[model samples]
Target: MKDSPSRPLYLAPYYIWIALFVIAPIALIFYFSFLDLTGAFTLENYQNFFSSVYLRMTLSSFWYAFLITLITILIAYPTAYWLTKTKHKQLWLLLIIIPSWINLLLKAYAFIGIFGLYGPANKLLQALGAGPLQILFTDFSFIFVSVYIFIPFMVLPIFNSLDKINPALIDASRDLGASSFTTFRRIIFPLAINGVKSGVQAVFIPALSLFVITRLIAGNKVITLGTAIEQQFLVTQNWGMGSTIAVFLILFMIIIMMLTGQKEKGGLYNGKTK
Candidate 1:
């Protein structure tokens, strides 16, 4: 039998946009990564980036972003489940999404007001008879600000996934002698993994390149690949080296995406449907 027509109207525009925007930019970046300061082909920039401190900074950025992704998934799961089941789900969603509309630079500055040496957080600790705290401009501040800024990104995908689930499924699991925890573990979590994967990708990519928040919150003591890239472009004007670092970051993201894709495919083949 001949197949019915698919959604060409929807698919055509999307494919064209993807080709023009996503595919084209990635190709340009890959090409630029191999170009030298004089616009000649060279691998020296890539070699320098992988040599010593730059390599460590790049790996550290990815590592910390990974840590934040793990934490966001753990934190978001329960909140998403709760909101999905709650009566005021729309209101909860609005609360989650509102922060995202705020300017990211403004949000980073706000953290400075909270964690700066004389900021409210430190003042509160001092009032409680604790010693002067040095939190801002540290690794902890980097993690804290990055996670806070990205929490909504993590929450929304998970909430959408959880909401797609039928309440009847949970009830059926309970009826079949599964405790609430058992139902969650065996049924809910498996179904939610796709959303979790999306949330991880959303948070990790931005967090990996977060230089403004790192500068404001971490006081320049903490360095990431993003900061290095900024320094390379603005201070040293080393486009080749910066582009090489950018390529490595892209490769790292691809590796993570591949691993996540495998997990998703494996889960699907094992009869776990989202």
Candidate 2:
């Protein structure tokens, strides 16, 4: 095998894009992480990151991301499984995904009205003889909105994985006296685990870094790593500390991807066997 002279030409745009957008930004962040407010090079930023305040923020961020991801998975798996059995599934799936095309800010604002004190949600609660509860600007509101936003992302991957399953295997399992639950547990779930992994990867990473939903929905009651980063860079004008947080965030993102990403040569059905 020899090199193709045209290969470099073909890959030039991709490499250039990565260098400019991905590599360059990461390099800049890494460089800035060691500098202080006065542009003096120091490790103080990293030192602050290890302190109790930051450690608590990091734990809280993880806890919130975990809850959002878990709720998304619980809802999405059932929705996707149902979609797989539908006649016009693609249409329904498209409907589910269309909301994601709308601007996130717009959606957040829409929820603000929906969950307002005198809004439909509270009105319904009042109709049921229950007093209007404060729904907006609460952890419940934040997690609910976040889960709603991420459901489509989670469903699409699981839907795709479920769709790829061979129909005959399911039929054989049923014919061989296996119950629906057993067949699903033994066959369908195993084959679809990769999609679950992909869905988790898609939902968890963004959930970890979400600031807008926290601001609009949670009303500063919940603060994640993203909120801290925004406060550092924009509010306090501390780019060094912000970049240090970003560098660590990037590291966490990498570690998660490594854990959830599938290998090319393995899985229950990559068409290869040992």
Candidate 3:
């Protein structure tokens, strides 16, 4: 396993690419996050980010993204669990992944087709005398589209985790006087939590960063940290504040990963590949 000259040369390009592209940008972000509008070093932006208004906005953003993450897990868990028991697992997986192949903007816009004021769902409801329904430009629409867009993230992890469970465990639980719900709660759910953690991170982080979909569907009235960052950069030209928020978001992500990763690493899962 010793690295030869040829091996070092072969991997040099990837190392250089990582250093230039990834490391360089991160370094720049770190630098910018500490600067002020006048090119002077300052902590004013960070202080403002913790003020009541900005803090409330950031908390609201986390809360909404959290709601989206919870909803995605609740919906995807059952779907993924059922899919694992299906006869055509590959086909189901393909179907699940098909939406991801479409452009994210296109997929977000496609929801407009089904949930807009004159969209099919509303039209059908009106035709049935259920009256017109408001579906777009609201938190509800935001949650719905976010869930749809991120479902695959939640599902894939759960599916992978569920696939590792020995079915015989369930049979044994049943024979030992446990009901289906009890066994799942006691055995299946605990074991699958790692996957759940991974899936939730995948969904929540990106969902928190979503600005385009929020702008389009939430009428730009609802402002999350994502929207705040975008407005700071694009609208207000306040790169200092934008970078501060971005840095905060990155810190928040790291904190979440550390907490979840600790739980995962300390768990009973012994790296047994299924």
Number of backbone collisions per candidate: 1, 0, 0
lDDT of each: 0.78, 0.89, 0.83
lDDT tens digits, residue span 32-135, model 1? 78888899998888788768878678778878877878777778778888888789998988898788778878988888889878989899999999977897
Model 3 Cα lDDT, one tens digit per residue, 80-125: 8999999999799779977766777898888878888789989899
Ranking by TM-score: 2, 3, 1
TM-score of 3: 0.90
Decoy 1 TM-score against native: 0.83
Error of 2 at 150 (Å): 0.3
TM-score on alpha carbons, each prediction: 0.83, 0.91, 0.90
1 against 2, candidate with superior TM-score: 2
Q: Which of the numbered candidates is closest to the native, going by highest TM-score?
A: 2
**What is the alpha-carbon lDDT of model 2 when measured against the actual structure?**
0.89
Score candidate 3 by lDDT: 0.83
lDDT by residue (24-117, candidate 2, tens digit) is 9989999999999999999999999999999999999999999999999999999999998999999998998888777889999999999999
